[model samples]
Target: MEIFELDKEQWKDFKLHFKWSSDKYYKVDIRKTQTGLMVELKLQTTDKPIVKDYEEPLWQQWMDEESDDEAQIFGVKIDSEIVGWMTVGMESWNNRLRVYELLVLEGYRRRGIGKLLLDKAKQIARQKNCRAIILETQTNNVNAIEFYKKQGFEFDGLDITAYHNDDVERNEVRIEMVCRNF
Candidate 1:
């Protein structure tokens, strides 16, 4: 039930979920034991490093995302295990403090881990005097859409083809989450 700042030492448990494309989805694993959660992936091959193509600089940047305290990232750990992660940052459109990427591991999902992460993020936002908590999710992630809705997030409307490329589509719908300070 405690949230800590993400560190490289926890990499053995955290991996990025990558969407190569709608039909060809794959999670690019970070196999190194140095920093950040090097999430164990079932799909990874034994002999090769986890990230083969988009490695190095991107890996460093991914690690950097864990701590932008002006915009912070927090990891939920129980019994020395990282169960979830969430972030609070500036929304690009309004320049308002927002909580964006939120994720709880697959097996850890539905155990209220996500709520714990969000609750911590909300406290952080209030401390920072943030306007609200905002997030963007793709239509394909129906479960997340529903979860956010139940958490009091309301549709601000949809963005047309917000993100799309030849290899992938970023047509994510944006939802706004307001955090009212008590």
Candidate 2:
């Protein structure tokens, strides 16, 4: 397997292995999505809330994160097909970077692919002068939570009622983790 940069143009067919894992472990509604589920960060957030609001433009805020220095997008390719990916980016004014998306394809799990991607992100985070790293996943995703813990991350906070009518899978909870450069 190899890792390379990825752009939104390549996102059309490169969705993570979420559905397959969801089917076996959890379940998918196949109708609604929680794409609009923000981190419920705080009363004053700088992201511009491109996901839920309808003021300026729809995907403008999404694209805002794609800037070169602030973020790095990588696609894991194997056998001429894209199977996994990891995106690392920094949160402005926080001195902490994060692994935005870390995923491996369905039949590609348990083969160390996810670990490789995660390690790569950590390496990059340290190189970028990040005092720490942060990432989030659903509470029900026990596998991911465990994986993050094994990688030296610790529980930082929780966002209750993160998912409701916006997603068919209601009552979903979001948990946050932080890893110091120590």
Q: TM-score per candidate, in order? A: 0.58, 0.66
Give the per-residue lDDT of model 2 (tens digit) for 53-126. Answer: 11121122343364346456677788898777776777756777777777776678777787778777777777
Over the stretch 36-100, how does candidate 1's per-residue lDDT look in tens digits? 55632122222422221121111233433543444455788878887777655654345355655
Q: In order, what is each prediction's RMSD in angstroms?
A: 13.7, 11.4
User: How many clashes would you count in candidate 2?
Assistant: 0
Q: Which candidate is the best by lDDT?
A: 2
Overall local distance difference test of candidate 1: 0.53
